[model samples]
Target chain A: MAFDAFQKRKERQLLWLLLPALVPLLILTIYPALYAVYLSMTNEALTGVAAAKPRFVGAANYLRLFSDGRFWNSLFVTFVFVVGSAIIGQFVLGFISAMALRRKIVGAPVFGAAILLPNAAPEVVAGFMWISMLAGGDHATLSKILVFFGLPYVDWLQTFPLFMVVMVNTWRGIGTAMILLTAGLAAVPAEVYEAARMDGANPRQMFMRITLPLMAPTIFLYMLISTVSTISVFGLVYALTRGGPGNKTEVISVYIYNQSFAAFQIGYGAAGAVVALVVSLALGIAYVRSLKVEV
Target chain B: MAGISEKRSGAYTLLAYVTLIVISIFCVLPFVWMALASIDSNVQLFLKWPDSVTFDHYTKVFAEENGVRWFANSLFTVLSATFIVMVVAGLGGYALSRSKAWWKQPFLYAILLIRVLPSTALLVPLYKILLTANNGIGTVLRPLVGEHYRFVMQLFGFIDGYLGLIIVLATGQLPLALWIMKVFFDGVPKDYEEAAILDGATLVQRIRRVLIPLALPGLAAAGLFAFMSAWGDFLLPLILLSSPELQTLPIGLFRAFLRVNEIDYGLLAALATIYLIPAVIAFSFARRFLVQTFSGGVKG
Candidate 1:
């Protein structure tokens, strides 16, 4: 365990280097996390001073969250949104694109970059685009198209705001997922595919038994990140529906914002915020464990 | 391989190309619509497209409104924040890479905790901290630095201004930037640095002359990521900035689009399109870097 002077000096230098980064990390991040935990336990309201005489309400917030119908509904909406967008919509579309491109199809690089355009587009803009398309032309693009195809011109936001939001989120998210998956697809050794093909494994069979198994870690990581991202689906929903013609599209993040900023229920809002953090933390831990197993 | 596959793979290649083209068009259709609608006149916007287009909205946005000022404010704020974050994360990442330090694991976990913590949770406490600044230690510091500093550099000054947005956005972006830089730095073999050190190079010299040039791509990727995160940001600006002139593109676009009473899809599309240009350009340039970052980080 006799370390050289160089090693000791290196360690000292490293510590010195990390200190500047650590300050903001501590102030902006660590302090906020601790403060949130502190805020969650209080009976403080949004309008007033955080109480000098506040009573501690030990898990009262958590208890209330379970009973709240809105919380449960929002949670369901969040899951569906993530699954629809991140998992099925983006993830699958992304995988297929990656797979096709991996076959060394002509213009793959151009398509690969093109696929990322949606993810790169500003969310606010995405909302507008979807709204315009779904809203249909006044003379009626959807209606005309639907009629031509023997379908109905459904009012997307009114009857199907949740579905609309999920589709929009998926549209935006597919690019990122596709890009990550393409990278994952690129990393798979070509010889493995060749060997499988030589063994008379059909493309579908190879995908299921070999490609899928090898790509599990990437899939899991994408799932976790996508889930975390989708849970906070605020901007798209906000821009599209404003939590709706009813409360149909009101996910947790928007609800929290309304409660805190608009409704001015500071303590209750903090409680909602804490719940989101806890749920995400649980997911994060599960993801980290899975990552550990993969490694 | 190409000649052998020319006929058989030709059909499959055609199918793939067709599918990819369709998807790409669908992906870019929003932007196409946005550009079309932005220049569309008010009647054309609300009613339908005519044989021609107009630039009335863009003109209005540029001249008769606070849109230009807001855009400038956003650029200034986000750029400043991005610059600050790059410097901090670069230094921090270098340290983390080079050292087998005592607090390294804890430091990394701390950064992760920050990364995972939702922005909503921090709003209340941050608000309180800003609200209380000038009354206490702030007063003491204010007099020492003269009243000008208080007006210009105080936390309260930052609380609702571009400065505050810069700090919060920079803070939010710091952990990721640091992590990316750390990974990038880690990938750079230590042998190069070891040779430099043995040749009597100082720490700064080794960093400036050896490490930086090698890590330019990583730095570009990190910088672009930071810029996008700050630029397309909504929550931080929404929570912190109350001034209309202080709004960023995301917030501004959201505001314009969410004018529920009016419900102008054409104007909304136009505004959204305008808002999206920077991101589209930035991502187009940095797409490869972005893909690499995600894959490398997630792969590990």
Candidate 2:
């Protein structure tokens, strides 16, 4: 009877210990998530200082988003951005770098560390730096260098906004992918590579037959994560162009921010946020499921 | 046969060097240009590098009276926030790993949701909350923070200082830190904990001895991540700190870049490069640990 009473008291104490941790999560994370969903359905001007109150509007905000031209453009740009940077940039660059540097190339480790520098830097700083570099004017050295080499100074932001964002983001993101790929590559035991080499397999054959297969799970993980990261590419866009050269580089997050803060169209912005949520949810679920299947 | 193999290997090695060298150049070009631009005067930025060499911008960035304050604010916020996260995440993760408490899975999933949720969704609400707090109940939390010995408000010798910034960043980063530490702790088998328990060891002893020491590499990696994210974050500091004196490097760099009437590209680049240094050094040192952190997250 005494032991049962002691166990009950212990359980109560554990619950008390948990409440403090749980309360913060409830306040910050959970409440915000539910409130975001709620805001998505309301016709509110969310400019924080506005006198307007949020009113019920059902799915009108969402419906309007579907018909918006800029919304569609932003969505398309997001797809392009993710594919161009995360899928092709990180995946391809990372895999190739890992394969090429798999053996002892002189200064390989140093090279590996150097490649990660872009990602290590503050992203806003990177965005500003890239803008200064590519924004060819009297001071744009890259353009000048290209001109010296007899190549045309392409308008990176004006004529090629999405492309510029892609390159910059890709440059910034390659570090994470490279590091992940390196880990994945290191995990594949040397015996497999040695055995393949003993059978007169070339480097290409070894990478294709043994290395690629072993690295599939890692690649999938990297792809999903990189995709998510790419989708959330806002700081670069926000800093560099402010989604401009005429909204050419406006991504979903930027659009959402502008709507909510700049235009005071909180409801419209919340709807955009919902769309982002849905897209991310779909991608995240798919990634989680893929990871599970591989496991 | 040995000669043929040797030749082939040599050829392969040469090809690898070529590929790696190209990639490394591509990777470092933007950074190199950024560093160069910081030193170049406005006129020389358009000119060739041989003609464009000056430290005028670096001097400008440092000479700005507010620059020191901004750096101190950023360093203080990032360090304190990171410290809070390490403490909370370390303890919470251990509990999550060891105890199948009533709300464990639900709590974990909620954190996961927050971790994946777009920052856009939270920004407005968080802003409103901060505004409300600033206006309404700021006094209420002040005394509590005082009692807990944060004493940050008094120590910094500035009003509306690092304490507020630390709390927000720490809270924002909590989920990921907790998630990482949970994964790290989970990787340690239950038998070790059971053995400690069997040996009449207290819960703290088990955590201090078995769990923390085993998870050091993962903890280092996670701590590094928190540090980098906190240091580099732009939006939070931009929105939260209205005072010019409390701006972080990213925010300071951004404001410098965005100034109207004669944009200081040289100064902007210099500041950006300055802001980039810590992240570069920290991540490069912890590169291997970062790789493992990713793989471990994937596995989890």
Candidate 3:
């Protein structure tokens, strides 16, 4: 009876403890999310009668979104961005860097610091910094370097907007990917490697047989994070291209922003936002399930 | 065979060193270019090396443009948000960590769910809510404050205000902070708290005297992250704050680029360089904690 009373007291204290964090989330996150669903169903605008009245249109926004070529294009762009930056570019380069750091090569600290440095800059600041480098014409940083190499000065962002954004995001994200992968690497036992070496296992064989299997969970976790985060990446890309040189680089986040703010179509933007949220949630669940299986 | 294998290994090591150096240069060269460009005038930007470096652009940014105001606004918003996140997360985390409540896991999952959702998903509705709430507050205060109602309205109109942005930023950051702090609190041994309990310390007393000092590193890490997120944020400020004077550094720099018909590369670079300094300094100071937190996160 005494223990039960103490437990009840503890629960009450815990509820009080949780209140501060929970209130903001309830007001800001939960309320907004439910509100988004309502907003998505209305013909809402920042101006006009739609702004004031906002009559429920019920699935009309979703219908329009389904047919919108630009919406499809944004999805495709986001897919390419996530795949290019997170999966291929950052993952490959980050893994290589992690492996190299583990080898303890000369100037490793300097190399590590250099890799980590880009992340220190704000996303938009990094975007602006890159704009100076990747700016068009003979005077831009990349162009000048190209000129020295006896090559034509390509207007990089204008010509390859999607690719340029991917490259820059990969540059920014590589540090994070490297850190996560390094942690995974550390968790692998030295004894396993030693055992493989005793059996005269080649480096390739050992990595394929041991490292790949052990690192699967961590790799998936990184993918889950990077993919979702990359999908949400707006500031850097927005600051760099504003989803421009046409809608060529307009990822979902940018598309949502444009629809809501620039076009003043709040309902349409909320529809896109909902889709993006669903996609992220799906990816997160798949990853969690895979992680559970691995465990 | 052994000699040949050793030579091959030596060659691989050399190759690895070369690769590392090349990659480092690839990463660092942009910042070097930015530094050089920022110090040079528009015309000198194209030159391999400028005839003379100047701080004229920096002077122009501060004096001509309202760089100082934007900087101050950013500092105020980020600091306030970080402070709120730390306090709320610290209290909540300690409770969640120590309590054996049946609902703890469900509550944690809910927080994680909210965290994973793209914050952009919330932005549209949040903007609406802020607008409606501001208007509602304005209506309520008008009758109460009489002639000073306009002044009160401005305070309530959070859409273009500091308070609104801080709330939104803190909300977005809270889940991560709470999760990190909970992990840190869980790692703290129960001995100290138990002793305090035996000594007849109240919950607040135990928390103040025992829990906080032990979780200082975690708090610092969480605070640093919250600060960085708030500082680097573009979309929140872009959507929430509308006034020219109220704009943060990112918006100010972006507008600076947009204002000129022809982009002034040197000036833009200088503004960007200045904008980068606080983040770089914060990152350098908190880098150890940041890395430790991430590694711990992965392990957990």
DockQ score of each predicted structure, in the order shown: 0.52, 0.50, 0.58
Could you arrange the candidates by lDDT from highest to lowest?
3, 2, 1
Q: Give candidate 1 misplaced runs (Cα > 4 Å).
A: A1-6, A48-54, A104-106, A136-144, A147-150, A293-295, B1-18, B42-50, B134-156, B195-202, B261-267, B295-300
Cα lDDT for residue A167, candidate 1: 78
- Considering summed lDDT, which 10 consecutive residues are worst modelled in model 3 chain B? B291-300
Q: Could you give candidate 2's per-residue lDDT for residues B1-300 as a string of tens digits?
A: 889978988998888788778878877877777777777664344433534679887788779635677777788889888887777777777666655556676666656546656677676666555556554444655665667533443333122456556777787777777777777777778788779878988766876888778877767766777888888777677666766666788888777776768687777777777778777777776666665555434311
Question: Tens digits of per-residue lDDT for model 1 on B5-84?
Answer: 46756666677777788778767665565677776665332224544677767766667556787678778888898888
Which lDDT values do the candidates have, in the order given? Answer: 0.72, 0.73, 0.83
Sequence-dependent TM-score of model 2 = 0.87
- Ranking of models by TM-score: 3, 1, 2
Worst 10 residues of 3 chain A by lDDT: A286-295
Q: Across residues A201-253, which tens digit of lDDT does each residue of candidate 1 receive?
A: 76678889988999888888888877876776676777777776667787888
Instruction: Estimate how well candidate 3 is docked, as a DockQ score.
Output: 0.58
What CAPRI-style quality would you assign to candidate 2?
medium
Q: What share of the true interface contacts does each candidate keep?
A: 0.54, 0.49, 0.63
Residue pairs of candidate 1 with colliding backbone atoms? A46-A266
